[model samples]
Target: MTFLHTIGAIFIFAPFLAFIMFVLLSRKKLKRRSIGFSADLTTFLLFISVPVSVESLWGLEISFAVAVTAILIAIFLLVIEWKKSKEIEVLKYIRKTWRLYFLLLSVSYILIWATGLALTVISFA
Candidate 1:
């Protein structure tokens, strides 16, 4: 239980975790930072962190929300691509979907922390 709480505390601030990991990984392996690789890696970390953070924040497991959000974002991106070109570009579609997820999840992660902090503050007051 204590171990899990420690991990929860770390992942609840996953942006910092992701950034540190990215920096160290890039420094160890590549001389120059690759924006594309960084984005993809950060997205993967955010995906993992979202559910963990949500559960830690409110004691609610929201892995379902994360899964549904991913599916919806993919569908939304596909629809936009299909409308513009009347066909799907597999590679482009995947990139767009992943980037969109990163965008939404990053925002959501911040909001979750902010709300958690607000709730704690209010409770103490």
Candidate 2:
């Protein structure tokens, strides 16, 4: 792969790394602040990367698939939280993190689109 492709790959998979870090730190209870940051960053990255990764891998046209996946996950979490008597916690979490989600989603969409445009221009030249 070229340097651009390498960079794109890193951008695409960065959230997965953040997720691993979050899980590991949370498990060991090593750093609460870092864990929170990682968790939030992971969610943001996943929201962005999932669609880009899907498009890149499958050449699909739909972008809302990631949103659907997120909704499904939220529903699943809601069910679990309901059973635990924390029914509103998921909504609260979404409210708190919605900005991060929106920012990442916008940024990731732009980055992926720019990369694709650049690649197209390069190919045509």
**Quick one: best TM-score, which candidate?**
1
Give lDDT: candidate 1, residue 25.
75
Please list all clashing residue pairs in model 2, or write none if there are none: none
Model 1: how far residue 111 lies from native, Å: 0.4
Q: Tell me the RMSD of model 1 versus the true structure.
A: 3.4
Error of 1 at 39 (Å): 2.0
- Model 2 agreement with the true structure over 1-125: per-residue lDDT tens digits: 59988865675666556567666867665566655556565666667575766577458855676677557765765676678785467557575445446455656665766777788799899
Worst 10 residues of 2 by lDDT: 95-104
Residue range 1-125, candidate 1, lDDT tens digits: 99998875675456657566666778767656555566677887788787888888788998888998789878887888989998788998898788788788888888888898899999999
lDDT for model 1, please. Answer: 0.78
Model 1 residue 118 CA deviation (Å) reads: 1.7
Worst 10 residues of 1 by lDDT: 28-37
